[model samples]
Target: MTFDGSWAEGREAPPAPDAPDGPVRATTSGETRRWLRPPWVRLIVLLVAFVLADTVVGGIDQGLDDVPVVGLPVGVVLAALVLFAYVKAIRFVEHREVAELARDGAAADVRRGTLIGIVLFLACIGIIAMFGGYHAGWGSIGAMLTTFGLMCAVAAAEELIFRGVLFRIVEEMAGTWGALVVSALIFGALHLVNPDATVWGALGIAIEGGLMAGAAYAATRTLWLPIGLHLGWNFAEGGIFGVTVSGSHGTVGLLKGTLSGSAVLTGGNFGPEASLVAILICGIPTVVFLRLAARRGRIHPRPRRASAAAAEH
Candidate 1:
């Protein structure tokens, strides 16, 4: 008996019609199985990485507290490194090479986001001032620089996790509206740990922090814009205005403004981020940005496995 030369190992060779049946050999498919991680699993990995980075950095910063002016810069560098690692790790795990994550006109995106954030925050404060809820005073330069550094680190870190990881993953899995709701709620819930946090404050954060930032990402598909917006909002609120941000005390501010009005309008001790006026101010842009994203086809669709199978029929 002669064997067929066309039979390859690990592949199911078709039964040769010319061969008289004696003993037939069976084989399995040659295709190698690869485990594709779902979006949610990737999101969990990103969150864990974030927590680890924050904890390690916090410990290091604590040790350097005795040194003057060194702790902040060191912490900033470490935080940036963590973000870089996160982006790299995610790219590897997802089997994608996203050059845009590194390049893609980052400077322009960040500048636009910063301008929008500053303008929106200033408008919120201006509205408060108009309503006699604000009193202005002067602050120190050292404090401003320190606050800027800290806020930049924070803005970059949070935006990477929320907009870069969670929002992006969820958008791919659940589409735009689903991502908007889930990300916004999670964002607001995270702020509940802050001092003097309130329900309305959390709700305000859900809309402004969650939805607005997600929309920003949806429009540009880059982290820089959200990071810049977050940096500007926090800096303008606490660093410039000298008001508490999410119930945290400000180190210093250029304007020593005192807010005194209804907590709903003034944002109470949680700063203007929790104010009703903030929701209104941020909501308009959120709508506009999301609309732009939709028009540009930037809003991603749900995974196509089931739909593709259906189409095959």
Candidate 2:
């Protein structure tokens, strides 16, 4: 037996070095993973939620006619509730608070862009009228107000769902290009449900409406810009000029008119969405914004294995 601790075989072994200890981040936030779910899963969940909300509201409006004493104002209230539920549900599924993710600067930029876009749209309308739109009776002030309010609400709801939720989710999973193409196709496809929708209409939407909306979202990082653009385009197309919107004409409008010539130019039965002019109107800005966004990094990145591992460790 050796007398000293190091006497074994007249040699000593080196002590093991300490393992690296670092922070470990979670792969998920542990909520519902709404955005991380398979594409079909997310789509189905959204479709079901929308249908359920619609059905419930429709039933209530019909069943309790006298509930509000005057009128239920069901459309307005339902719109608000639907918007709230959509925001809440998306947040819940993502397990991330929008307040935390939202950039104040981005929001401010979106608001500014929205205002500018609205002004540009109004200018466009004036220019179109000057060119030769048949201006008939300017409808009632009340009707105009109602039309504007409804259009704004509808725009907000659609923009929130498409750009805010679906676009964001796809961007998170599939990267920027994937998100743009996928969201655009789906957005265009959705319009096919409208009356008088045609192949041209669908393609035009994919390029003009869908791509423009996505680009605005990517650039602004807030739904406000897209919402305002959507609202203005629809109102200008339908309310101001008496053209169809999504192939449906409103009951009341600010003005009644016919496009001077050629449905190909003015959108004909499919409205502005099917016109080549519309593509030029929407596509230019869309491509510009997309280029800017790609430069700015507003499009979120898909998690790579190396990055994910580093994040986890």
Candidate 3:
């Protein structure tokens, strides 16, 4: 988390955790009109800015995705920028530090999440194997490395956008349950546009990915854990198991193992992300995280008005 990197310009301190109607962790010391500070307003602004940033950055990443060894280091830079984009936006709009992105919490989050993310997919592999869906074979170390780079570029970006921005901001207004629903729907809906996408695939992502990632953040209150989880799963899917990732056929994993049998069990061409087993595999953590969140008093009832939190710059 303390990288060989640093944000050149640090913003002001973030708001108090329980500060009135503003962001849950936004500063209440600023003077801003209520209309300007509504949670809805911040949500729209942040989403717009973040989406634009993701598009530009993602475009850049896609161009370099095939370049082999060069992609990893370059992708790292892009990933850093993506994180910076999230952190920078919070400062610019919320007038508060990004507590969820605190450097101190990053390493711990990765440690807590990465292995579990990998395990989730391994579980999927097990179920698919039982159904005669998977045919194991020798894998390529080179391919695994490629997928690792690919995952690194996308995982952090997706988590920061979904859990860090979309889910967290929405939670401040609608409460955890509402945020889970809205974010999951949107997340799944977005996946509908992917290659070989199906209604089932999108739904699977919603229940398995969006909800799970949101719950992870809800329980941990940081971005790294979700990022780690996302990365681990993607890497395992494409790198370790050599399975098609989210319908992207371009994935070159360590294993060239084939997935055969019923599409229902193997997720067919849309990848394991759409499999029934994935829903169950990813869902367990979602339930556990949500419960842990509730036990930690992380679940909040819907507020009368949205949080008016503005990021600090």
What lDDT score belongs to each candidate, Candidate 1 first? Answer: 0.71, 0.59, 0.77
Better of 2 and 3 by lDDT: 3
Sequence-dependent TM-score of model 3? 0.86
Error of 1 at 276 (Å): 0.9
Error of 1 at 81 (Å): 1.2
Candidate 1 residue-wise lDDT, 1-313, digit = tens: 0012321232222322232111111111233312336566667876788767766764664465344376458756875786687667765666554432555456666776777787889999999989988887887655565566666667777777777677777776777677778888999998899888988899999998889888877765667778878878887886688888888764356666678988878999888888989999999878876776676566765556877889999
Most accurate candidate by TM-score: 3
Summarize candidate 3's per-residue lDDT along 1-313 as a digit string, tens digits: 1111221122212322422222244443456534446677878887887788778767876686566677667766777888887888787677777778778647756865778888889989988998789986776776677667767878888887788778888888788889889999999999988899999999999998899998877766777878988988888888899888888885666787678888789888999998889998888888877776676567877766324433321
Q: How close to the true structure is residue 242 of candidate 3, measured as C-alpha lDDT? A: 84
Residue-level lDDT tens digits of model 2 in 84-156? 7876776555444453124444344444544545544555455555656434566544444455555555665
**TM-score, cand. 2:** 0.71
Q: Number of clashes in every candidate structure?
A: 1, 0, 18
For residue 134, what is the lDDT in candidate 1? 84
lDDT of 1: 0.71
Q: RMSD in Å for candidate 3, one decimal?
A: 7.8
Q: Show model 2 residue runs off by greater than 4 Å.
A: 1-43, 51-79, 99-135, 300-313
For residue 95, give model 2's deviation from the true position in Å. Answer: 1.7
